[model samples]
Target: MGFILLINFTQQGDSDDPQSAAVEQFVIGENKVILTMNIDQQVTIERAGQGWRLLPAQRLSNQLIEQMMRTWQQVQGQVLDIEIDRSQQSGLFISMVLADQPNIQLFTLYLLAEQVVVHNHQLDRYFSLPLPMFNQLIPTGLLINQS
Candidate 1:
């Protein structure tokens, strides 16, 4: 059976600018959230009071993390046809957990030859992200030690 999911987002401030609209969709308050990604391997980052810390003693450079968060906050993408096949190998899987929320939002992304396909389980919809933005956000070495 096929299921349909609808995305509910509110336009904050300027609706004409896609960046501002994208930023409004995800609001990470006080850094009270955990971001995890699994591509070739799994790496997780959690709020460390004022900053972010990687798991298992890996130190992610503050600058790199900040840049990634900025990209995520301003990411712009378009929804593709919902009938696309999802049986291909998933290239990336990301999940976010809010400190005050009980549910974990998950996104599965497939890196195709021409486009990046993202499946947002929370919204039950698929989106095609810009290649540049996808490259910025999905670097395999971003979770490594920077020191």
Candidate 2:
């Protein structure tokens, strides 16, 4: 992952002298996971503008896909300050392609009997989410691949 973020600074206000300067803050551009592949390589969800598409042509509707993407973006969790032993957990791998990043991001999800923990390797952080939200994040039973 060789993605580099570049920030541009612009001069604000009309100042004849270059002595006093106030820097204007602009959106550094948020990174969105435009494409994601499942752990089993069974399904792929990709974002195209305002819509989303499922690879292998699942029977899922566009509205549902959009909702799933929204959930992925808006979902929040409780921060876990401690480290988890990922070796003993049953987990899944998700590979994502951020909108503005050139490199792909990888994440590991450890599903427990209670909560779902996601390890954001990029940020080196962990989040603990509710157990039921797992279905919304990666809805099961969509693995019936079409020829």
Per-residue accuracy of model 2 over 55-145 as CA lDDT, tens digit each: 8787777777776667776676665655777666656767777766787776777778788887777776677788987777776655553
Q: Per-residue lDDT tens digits of candidate 1, residues 1-147?
A: 122222222333245665543432332233344444333346776666676676554455687776775565455566554645556464566777755668776777676777776776766767677566565676546544311
What would the TM-scores of all predictions be?
0.62, 0.67
Report the Cα lDDT for candidate 1: 0.58
Regions of model 1 farther than 4 Å from truth: 1-41, 143-147
Model 1 worst lDDT window (10 residues): 1-10
